[model samples]
Target: MSATGPAGRVQPARPGDPSHIGPYRIAGRLGAGGMGTVHAGVASDGMRVAVKVIHPEQAQEAEFRARFRREVELSSRVTGPHLVPLLAADPDAPTPWLATAYVPGPTLNQHVLAHGPLTEGNLYAFAAATAQALAAVHAAGVVHRDVKPQNVLLTPAGPRMLDFGIAHAADGTSVTRTGVMTGTPGWISPEQYRRGTAGPAGDLFAWGALVAYAATGRLPFGSGAPDVVAFRVMSGEADLDGVPAALRRTLEKALAQEPGDRPSAAEAAQECVTLLASQATQVVGADAVPATAVDMVTALWDVPAGEDPAWHLPPDRSPSRKRLIGAVVLAAGVIGGLAGGVAALLPGSTGGGTHTSSSTASVPPSSSTGSARPLASTAKDDKDGTAANRQASNGGSATAESWALTRTAQGAGEHDVARAVLHDEGVVAQELGDGVGFSPKSVRFQESRREVYLSYTLASDEEGAMYAETEIARNMCLTVRDVVLRLHPDLPYRTYVMVKEESGRDPQVTWQDDFVANSRCRSAADDDSAQDSGTDQDSGADQGWQPDEDGLGQAMIPSTDGAEIRVADGAARKIIAGTNGIRRTLGTDRVLGNAEIKVGFDPGNSVMYVWSDYLEWNQEQVESWADLAAGEACRALVRERESAGSAWPYSRYAVAEIGGSGYLMIRSGTATTRAACPA
Candidate 1:
């Protein structure tokens, strides 16, 4: 969701630039560095991400790819408010790429060059925040070899430390290449130059130099040729002129010739925080930021008035639910930065989901093979035959390359398939024709049955969406059958079409069925197996379920056998444990079936939700699957609530297994057991 900034901030992508990378759609170029070009990209769920793709020449080297992979692993582990988090990565791809949550702001160097050196509260906050970022990096056993001014981005929230590209674990492994300088001139530590080794201490040296430079708008060590800077660093020469009295002493200690003499990142952060509180404003706690500091930092940027609203950093005064979810994601460490591509590699993550501004859905890897190969094989079964032939039929090597890229991304479930459709927006639109358009943001894919959910937002209200629902479904089916299905024809493709009102209410499912090119998109009467169209009709005709006054539906639970009840007892015990209870294996009963139900909690909202890839679009199929899952989950909750006399503090819970199907059968109830719980 990288915002299109003013001219110099984000440049248009060149003709040579990639239109898409993995599951992200590249929007514009952010910048280029030694490693590779960084592009502003958007995820399928409209999350803005900063994607860093390695240089082709560098990617050719086996050593570089190994380091890049290590960088991704290490970066994902280091998370903090002042540090950019790694989102997704595929170092094994032809040109290895990694994506991070996009932070829109000028680099520390850029800010200083345009607005001069920071003063008072702004300078103090920057130092403390950057130190906190370093502490987080070091806590993860990573040493950021390059912690220069240009790598720190300034935002209203505080400073964000970027580019752990050269960071390596503190286990003493060498990440440096022969004949390559690991750090920028005038910033590299004396130890790095003299002994050719850098540890966490070197990062401290750079942090001090960075803060000093920010205070005085000059390099701590005299700016000169590389040799001269190295000499200055080795000679322990540093200038702290014009620096504040209290901060100058700390900077002097940080620039000590001996690595051990410098304060630890934690100590430095506390010292800066203390200095800011004493001079500028009162700090509530050691960790709490002062309001004056944030105000000063915000004033320093001077962002243009008409810039994209998406570019605004979250307000410093209040924490919204969106920010709370972000905090949860960073704290949970389960879905830390590595959302799409590398989820399988994370310690206990079954797979990751695409997180949008509001909601998220996790899809486990192909349960059939427990690997990505099956997904690639699905695409290989394209109408044109083998991947090579599919490429030729599509008219280029780019298609083959993109397909291969899709394979790397397939580890994250439907992300690969979703990217394929989004990348071909033009072709999909051409097939849909006038008045009807393909909504890129509305496209959500499910890999299990090759189901793609799409929506059309009407210019009018919900009534308007209902009025044209039939026509919209017909157009959507035609686009999918004629264009999307032809590309990957192997799977029994099922599609769901949703109609959304312009007023922003939740979209309602209008169509849920498979289609073939044999006849024009028709009603269920024409296609016997297809479910009837219209949201209201599907609910009443098939399930005979009605919504309560709150519009919350109830999950229908079937009679559970004694064996299923016993299994539910064990699951109840685990759920009450409050750790990673949902993901742990709940021993299956024959009645429960094989499909695993994975649960997630949003502590911010006090809601627990379940997700499963086994659910389908058909009403009957959904009911069948929902019964088993709902009964088991409900029994577990009932046991915990009744036996322990504790409701576990969750106010509401839901079943959203068929996410992106648009027709989410959300059954909301209290954490306490309900009538649906098996007796």
Candidate 2:
């Protein structure tokens, strides 16, 4: 809040203005805006100050304070002379008030109005200072959503950027209502008006507009009702009537409609500062910082210890750089003597695999242990403890999950975090022989994408152990997926489980299956290759079921683990006909376009898994399309089954649409149902 009267307007204190606020005495009102009212005051220490006190109604809104606090946090980190400095703040007061270092200056709006448009050199210098300030602000991941002439205070030492009550994070969050218009109209960025998150690039767009405004003395998108101006900005129709050629080239790129197309605030400022480098040296004066990003941010921002202002500042790029703090957790590996093969590693059982002679440790629910059950399984285990509970809390209230898991292995020294995640000793704990142990490395959670990436380094690098290590990596994917869903059930994201190969630091993405991506069923039964992977588990070879080979009749019932099918003769033909109907309907040029649809018979169940290249499983609306496509496909199959004297409803064979990052959704229950196994 620059003292309004020194070089600008002399507005009197309002009739209702208070004489005293906190320990300061209000001398006069400086200005009033939508966010708050600024007043020139005298502190108890006899220091002149500019205090901004929020309006009562706006003070009551929690989100306003959240944004204010975010602004304060970012502002405090940035003491650039061109940007306003946050001296002290008491936002929790009945009416929030923040103090800033008093500067006697007129805003660019007032300066331009009184002194006419700026000369080319003056405009370039002002843009340099503002850009330098913005670079510091943005380096702290803060975006000054409002960047116009009025927000700039034209002091003798360049220009100072102010009014940060509407600042937001660089990643963008719902600090404000979605799609609601924000910031001053004529100066707002196209993305800000287009119902999307306005990032740091938005501020740069505004900076471009401000530069244009100074150069031409006109609003870029012509002032009008916010709706009209927003329309113009979103449509890329700004009225740059008189911008000079040299400035126009730089400003045009800054005013690009796409955020990615625009230059960063730092880059734009550097261009102008570089052109006027000789003149800028004299412009810094005694208080203003020089024209570099680092100099602006690190210069006047430091406070004298505990006296520094209060507000949450985001940690530096990495947690390690945040502060000098450290902790050590007991990430010790599992220690158990092996007696049998890996396959018979199940609790209280002995198969061919190397078994651990350790007590079966009871794990709490999947929620407590971050355990999740996959939808599919290789072989049926009586004590597998309910693989997946399809029931939602509100009776299947969920449409379909858009959550996906993204696994990556790029973190340096991330073995500990990964070790802790895979550190659990489940009921079926087994130790593989010789040199095939994995040390849990690291796991990363992507909040925006809602995906988790886990990286594991192979503790052993012996020859001929790649296959065993890869299997361990596969197992980790299942374990990590269950853990992530159990922990973050509400997130609409995915998890990627990856392991470091024995040879190098490259990630061996062990779990890329649709089940892992969508957090759905596992396909262990279909993985006859797992037996050849040297794990001693029940190979599907002994099962009498062969829906694909023997067809889905009573004869295939023996192959099923527990389900009992009571299908009459010729039931397979009818089911095949019904499936064909769905294939033709979905495979048409319009529905899935030229995408190939692969329909495979689920081994034990009469159900099937319909995969299509056209399926965008990650989309929120994919479930409806899946239901429509599967419904039509199953309608024909059901109709044929009924005509063949079988009692099967389309509802019984309904597909539960699940989204995978780049995989086709599975129609779980109905895709494998051979011939109606009634309860």
Candidate 3:
């Protein structure tokens, strides 16, 4: 069975065509579109498959080719029964084609068209399955940017989601066009059309609209041209005429225009499944529950216990169960601090009781007894305070400093605190927002060897805004900054103080700069000596020094001639003089240390440095250098705070690296304030 091309054109059946894709063989053609053509292929074993081939015209576009590659990559990373499994793909071929596990059934659109509106049972099943699929896709950090009835396959097994060609990663990706809209007009969310940012919630909105279509056999936003449908979506109007009352609330919430207001896919699935069970009870009358009903009841009851709190079950029974178990185990292992309830549900467990010999106690048997640890425990912890502070006045070279800021009744003192901190550190600081109405405050600071940013929110009078208010604000701010510094111990940057002012006006902000300047800073100040070696590669040294590897620190040294450098308790070593290749090793003996890479020429002239955590390189030094260089472009760095079941030491970091210097630095702060830079 060969693949089909655009407009339902059939490609010649070749020797490689095994008459199947996953479980289905080529039976005939179903349809075609501008993107690809679908062929009715069958699985060699016994199931049916749908194979899609890129249109000749689309295949010619480099952008389309990149998107196609991403589709394959994302599909390969996710596993769920409700999601059409990518059985095969050959993106490198002149005519790229992808084959998915055959789902022997009509699309939701076709089914609704042929059989009128779906029954309550079918609709509930559809909702649960779709939500589960969306949850799985989102967990993998990818959003199904295109979700609609035409892309949903209704099979005896359940509703299987197909086509993720336009999926986008939540962390952001470079492949997508900046402002392109992708997906069916009637079913798309407003966010998708407006900012072109489709996250997990956007998919939920589409799911709600899709459910409405299944129930009433009409578009949720009413029948209209693409433009009109888009207008309705943007306006937050959804027609839910025939939707069941049990699902009305859930649908309404899911269809909310604001992304944060929508229920997560897992929550939606649970709601749907619960409703279906309740409906089944009503239909069966007062008679004894049937075996099928009993099984479903068992599954429903065991869902929370057997699955991860984050686990979402697809409509398909087998795969959903597998995912549930996997999620349960993974969640349990990482959240040990909170796994007491879950530990009791393991197999062959004994009841909780005291043991006389001081041995570890075992848990009782139950569905939830796997483990109860958080996922973040797996990462290594890096201490944020100085070694001297950590060791309490030891004779070691390490010294630690701590700064505090407090806001008074006045507006948020974030900017003031930021400026003070940066000034004390001898680094530049910039205030974000025109310093208006409860906006968060930010400051950039630089020492002779490092630069960092500290961001904190002020308390607002409103009850809802108090979380960002008061003494807790300073604590929270410091905690976030400390976590980031700990993760990248090698980086020179450190955020020491975060304060909330109680005064109505901006509070006083203060900081301390380095008492001793390094050789790098001294060399950067000399021009005549630096310019004498005009040929020196480091001759372009800028006053703005680039951060070193690990995004924790900065390095400033003469870029003129290579020189021998010595470190505390370390042998002197000769490094290249003129080139930009200066390597700094991190976390060698103590928690942190400073190193220098001598550039041959004087460092007075301004130089541009680039730093990025994502830079690709094979050599260790080069990779770290690249990270330092790329960090310059970032405005701030944020690390995930520990939660009930997770301890993230370094979930994410926002950094700002000087664009041209190949210098990189990481600071603790919010991503919202980071200035957009070219990819």
Candidate 4:
């Protein structure tokens, strides 16, 4: 991490800028915000960091200084694996500053503008990564309060959420004055706009909007003057013209007007991961670079003396989530920065729903298949095909081209067909319109029997939504019929609308069988299906060899006489048993899954792969057990080895599959390499 960083490449530090802050030698500048300038600085150790220094004028104010110190204290609390971990800080210094881990990449806004929207694979990875980051943030009990595209940074591993100056726990004190509206204008939630307190729910709304921008190159609510955009957001009038089909349902709930209607960050992440599995959104090539991190910027939305509050570096498209704190400056990320563009290649779009958020129905289990194509966009399906035709004739801007409907072959299996419909929000929203607005709750697309079904609570389920429920169902039926007939005109287009018992999970889960299960899908796309979403981790990913007919795989074996057998499991096991070479241990037996990686633990901890059957437990039962014991396993490993060596802190984490055995292994670190346990 150098004093002068990549961000400094854009603009050099001004003549008046300080040459050093603490041990960091100032090089150039990242950017300036209302609070202070963020410069690229290098420590004597040659570590590069983004240094935020407060302005002298503000530093003189005790109240402002207090806020800055508070922000630094709170910011230090957020130390997620991918977060911009705080490197150094000196709030009491004559010129106060804070340094953060510097990531090398463009912001999401810049990446999109330069690359013209992400591919379906990149988008899923992007969503998954952001969701993971948010999960960590929310788990820490801190509300980011602001999350938008500009704040997202695109890197090789995935997206990381940046900035925490203003982030605070819901149970903690509020950073901004009460009644002050703080946040980006267009991306803020209705509750926040009305000055209501928001939690993770509000951030979810911004996440949906950010995804929309990534896919359509436009905000869900078309960009407009502040008042207009705010009105549209409050009114649930989203402009989801070109978003892809698969993602609409999830995004709809995420963007629901009610803060309570959005899925938890973890749930949203699972949806993205699963949807990607269905869509086969895997890395496309050797050169493929996965995106990482969110953007940050600063802006002020004013309220009168009796009134409100307000809130990048990326682009107006600028860096999205502005840093919450900086020296005399109460906040960081003063704008006017570099960043990009509009390209549509996504799953869905919507205005919102009145439904309350609910947990997903039990996911049967993990699964995969690639025979899928994105469900066609519904913007073209509006009004009995008239608009679709017009748009196509006019070059498909509002229809197919922007959405980029992947061509489908005949008889794409029931599995593939179910995926297209269940995943695509544009198709669902357009087909099921105003009277029948329905946000997706849970959808299961079974390949067998060509069945695609998921439960749904009405979009609102409030008085307005209930009153229109009947009509919504009627319209939903009509649209489903038309959509079915259009896609599988020759095959049996069977769609049944049923009402099922309420699960009582949400008050809004009003109707039984509130879902419409339809199958017009005839076949999976050919070329896409051929690409493997993942190879067996044992053979391909981990660079391990598959066992031969007799179970002799690639390994190295040496006997006492110095005799050796090449590619022998004996040799491999012996080699792994030693500490100097392979970092992790190889399972001695083939009973468990050949490849098992541990997750959620610090490195340098020992672990052993165990079979569920050996313990008389089923895979499901053991999986749950492993999750609960992952941390303990590392601690135990450290404890058991304490007499032998010093127990350093555990740091390694990964999710590994226990061999073919029913149980999956979840451990922290290798026993031989990761222990510093005391005797």
TM-score for model 4?
A: 0.40
Model 4 lDDT per residue over 1-679, tens place: 0112122253444544665566556666654422345666664554456666654433444554577677667665655544454555667666666666454554566556566666565665566667766777777766766676656655444455665443321101111111122455567788876655677898888888888777776666654223334556776877666666777787888899888778998899778766555434243332332232221100010111111111012112223433334323222232112110000001001222111011111111111212221111122233243443353334212222222221222333332232223323223343445344443333232222232333343434344443333333332333334334434444343432222113332111121111123111111222312222333422211112111111100000001010111111221232223311212222223332111211111111111221122243445644544443333333444443454344433222222333332323233233332332111
Deviation of model 3 at 663, angstroms: 66
Model 1: per-residue Cα lDDT over 504-585, one tens digit each? 3323333344555322344323212333232232221222222221111111111012222233334433332322232233
- Location of the lowest summed lDDT over 10 successive residues in candidate 2: 338-347
Root-mean-square deviation of candidate 1: 25.1
TM-score of 1: 0.43
Cα lDDT tens digits, model 2, 1-679, are 1122333222455545666655556766554422345666565565555566665544555665676666655555654556665556665677776665454455566566676677645766676777887887788766667677766766544566765433332111111111122465567677665544667898899888888887777777764223334545766777677876667888889989899999988799778766555444445553564656434323322211111121121222332222212211111121011001100100111121121111121111111111222221111341231221222112321111312233332232122223323332111122442144333334554445444454444444333233433344344444444433433344443544332433422233333332244222232333221211221123211133222211211111111110111121122233334434555443433332111232323222334333333443445444534545454444445554555544342222323321233233333233222233211
In model 3, the number of clashes is 95
TM per prediction = 0.43, 0.39, 0.39, 0.40
Model 3 CA lDDT for position 505: 28
Stretches of candidate 3 off by over 4 Å are: 1-28, 42-47, 60-63, 165-181, 284-679
Top lDDT model: 1
Each model's lDDT comes to 0.48, 0.44, 0.39, 0.41
Shift in Å, residue 49, candidate 2: 1.7
TM-score leaderboard ranking = 1, 4, 2, 3
In model 2, which runs have C-alpha deviations exceeding 4 angstroms?
Answer: 1-16, 33-36, 165-181, 278-679
Determine the backbone clash count of candidate 2.
43
